[model samples]
Target: MPFRRRQLLALGALGAFAMQAQAAEPAAFPSKPVTFVVQQSPGSTGDLVARALGDALSRRWGVGVVVENKPGANGMLATSQVARAKPDGYTLLVSGSTPLAFNPHLYPNVPYDLRKDFSYIAPIQDAPFVLLASPRSKLTSYGQFVAAAQARPGELTYGSGGVGNSTHLVMEMVVEASKTTLRHIPFNGVGPAMLSTMTGDTDLMVSVLPSALGQIAGGKVVALAVSGKARVAQLPNVPSFEELGIQGPPTPGSLVLIGPARMPQPLVERINADVRVVQQEEALQAKFREFQTQIFSGPPSAGAGRFLREYEEWGAFIKARGIQAN
Candidate 1:
């Protein structure tokens, strides 16, 4: 053979050897600690779920899992941070429906686009909101609440976690459906909003089942109706908005896991599978029930589709009612 031909043959052999060597290397998906960024305060529902999941995942992967709380801007702060993080599957986000579904329609300029900036990992859980009235108020049932609102338009005050949040939007739906006007008082978080209602600062407020569970049990607030398709087991006596002939979104909020966009397909599948496995455990399911949330196990695409539907549905509602964040 000619000198150049021999040189080419030798290079081809070396290339084959390199490829074989690379193929022989072991797979190392999670060789380091993983971080889960939660979009709520330490004691919030989102934080609790994230910590539980992190604990389970850490045990499964035999690595440390850290949960970081970045609570502000209606969850925009934590969402933006995760959206911009490296898509190596190390950084993830555990958040509720506000940032993913409602924020885009509520704000003029959101920091990140849900479809473009993040990958939907899997849905964790979903829960309904209960319309609670101050015990001091005479609004014991849904009918009385509406009648009072209609009788005194803009006189009844309702508090929410914040402007453009699930608490705010769900109450807006109730007000529109009943054709009554109520003053809105947006608080910093659900805890404060629940407190305001219990203290009679606000006449009524819509709160997540878990957040309001204790208050309802303690008789601090009276649950007039729930914003769900059917009555929640925790509040069996409380009627649902649907039963009261109120048409609106099915649930008040949903929680989902997400990661930065452009994650490797293998990594996405692995994480999604692991999440499903984690949610299937009996212990975790019972824990989720304690939070008044149902465990969600579905294809990764389900989360994305739900987000899109909610965005459009809420956008139409907000536009029709001219609801703006305060």
Candidate 2:
């Protein structure tokens, strides 16, 4: 054969060999345990989401899924820590809008650039808050609560997780929309804030529905209004802020799955697809409904842009209202 023909055959053989080698390689994701670093203490909404996802993923992938809580700095600590982690798809961050979207604006020095240093993998859920009035306050309806707050401008106290938490910022949205002045009593976490409101130490509180569902069902607190676009089935009697003709917060607090920067697109898509499958399981969907959270299902690409949009929306709201990470 001529030299040119021999060279062409050699190149073709090399291409075939390369394709075969690539086909022989096994999928690398979830070959070992995946650690989900939660940005809130155990039992918080973020932690709950992480644990639930971890369990489901563990069962699906036949590997252990560890949930590590590094709750501090309004989620900056865990978020930055995960951002600096290896982008091997083994270490991920399960966090809410506060840390993922709002922290960069609420805190003076966020350690990570959300757009540059993180891969938004999948959205776990959209957990809207329920506006609860202490039963002792005799505020049965959202209208009545607004009237009382309006009448007693700064006298009626509302509790929140902290100064810059979603709990606090969302209430500011309510305050702005309602044009009422309610004094803020910041607590260590939404749990304590809910407790304070239940005991009537605070007259009103806004909390993620999962944490406040038991109390609401037992009549410990009056569920005045929820923060999402529609009323949740669990709280059918209670109305949403939109239903009451009130402008609610820009977004209901969201839980998202994310990893360090530079994770392969295939890996991100794999995880996103697996999570959507897990979310569709009837048992898991029922559990989510019990928690009063709506599943946020989408492609990985969509989640990436969604975070940027939410970041801008919440950042503007935070800056305009002078919210601070106190």
Candidate 3:
């Protein structure tokens, strides 16, 4: 054989051997421990859900799942970390609407692009925002809250996880629809923002249902209204914004699992399928119910589409309201 032909044949043989070797490697995903990066504080709803899902996944896969809380910069810290991580399915992000949908619109220079930087794995849950007033405050109902806001304008202060987060944006929508104004007090996370209302540091806040449930039950705060289309079962007495005559699309916050972009398609499908199975478990469902979370597990494409839709909706809303981060 000619020398060049022999060299080509040898290279082809080596390539075939490499492909066969790679195919023979273990097919089981999560061969090693998995890390879920969370963008909320330890006790926040996002953190709680991440830990719960991680525990369930660990049980299912027989591998350890770690929940890391890296809360700061309106969730940019953990989000950017996950966006830059290797797309090996080992490093994941348990993020809410903020990082994936709302932040790019709210910030002038977000580090990562939602469409280009991450792979949507699965949606975990969706919880409506609940308007809460300090138990000490006289604002006891949605009507009273609206009236007070209109009467006082910027005198009425509201606390939120942060500026540009779903918590803040939802409240802004409510205020706009009500034709009222409220001072925004941004905090590091829902836990701190809820605490601000409980301590009367802020007059009111619109927080995710799960994060505010404990406070509402303990009488530290009063449930004024929920931002869902209907009243939340956990707080039946609390009216929804629609029932209060406020009109707009429901502004529920969502939590989704994602990984760095360009992850293997098979790996994404496997993880998403497992998440759906875990979310449907009776025990997990009950646990999430107790926290006022409604499971929303679905296909990765659906999750991606929802994220994109929310990005456009929130971007328009923020611009219309002239909302800006502090």
Candidate 4:
């Protein structure tokens, strides 16, 4: 249900604020349609999650929620497009780890500023990455994997989406913490990287759970430890780095929804409230089974603060690690 004017008026300024939010707007706020700009390819985990949310929101609002996939230039094209959009909440950026938190440092000339450009809606989900090895490979356990990597430093190659991407950096953090070395192979995305590992072209792959779950269940890849503080419920037997007495920080996916910055406070609150509601629905919870993604719905204030902090931290992580695009 749309927010009642009476409830908004109870906040007093929020009612006046929401009314002004629609002023000086072309046509009306969302009078036409809303577009969700996803920086990932179609059928990707991030894209699928956004589509689900978009579908639900569209059904609720009686407006078309079209998802536009712009998967190039390391998400610069999509980020730039949305950064310049009107702050009327019609144009939302369905951002993943790369575009929002890690890109500004990787690219030489960024087209947009993450902190200055978007009003965060909520964190979509926080899934951890899984490390997989081929079934034929001798590296059976995490200890064996480490032994092989140590025996031939920079010999056991691992695939990631690209340098400075979450897959790459997380593994780098893993190797660095463990005082090990391996060859870092960069791919355009997780799909290709996982295929590389499956085909035996790469010895290791660090990828989000969704991209690797099918192969892991099919007995193609050896399910090694995950990069999380706790083991994923989906893969109950698979241990976590922390459980193994490993020392890396808790790593999780950074997918979140946002609009252009300076969006009206009331609009942000209204959307956040709706998302909090969406988070509680059984249908969406059932949908999470398909992807093994855990929803992390919260107010925009907490989500936005997370974005800001990670945006800065990733910038430093990128340069310090000397990760680069090929």
Global CA lDDT computed for model 1:
0.85
Which one wins on lDDT? 1
Give one digit per residue, the lDDT tens place, for model 4 in 154-201.
888888877777788778877876678888888988788888888888
Point out the worst 10-residue segment of candidate 3 by lDDT: 20-29
Each prediction's whole-model lDDT (CA): 0.85, 0.84, 0.85, 0.78
Candidate 2, residue 40: Cα displacement in angstroms equals 1.7
Q: How close is candidate 1 to the true structure, as a TM-score?
A: 0.92
Clashes of each: 0, 0, 0, 0
Question: Model 4, stretches more than 4 Å misplaced?
Answer: 1-29, 249-252
Residue runs of model 3 more than 4 Å from their true location after superposition: 1-26, 249-252
Tens-digit lDDT track for model 1 on 1-326?
99999999999999999877644442476799999999899988888888887888888888998999999999899999999999888999987878878888878898899889998888888777888999988789999988899998999999998998888889888888899999999999888999999999899999888888899889899999988678878888999888998887655467788999988766777788888998888778877877777777788897887888888888888888887765
> What lDDT is obtained when candidate 4 is compared to the true structure?
0.78
Model 4 poorest 10 in a row by lDDT: 21-30
Local distance difference test, candidate 2: 0.84
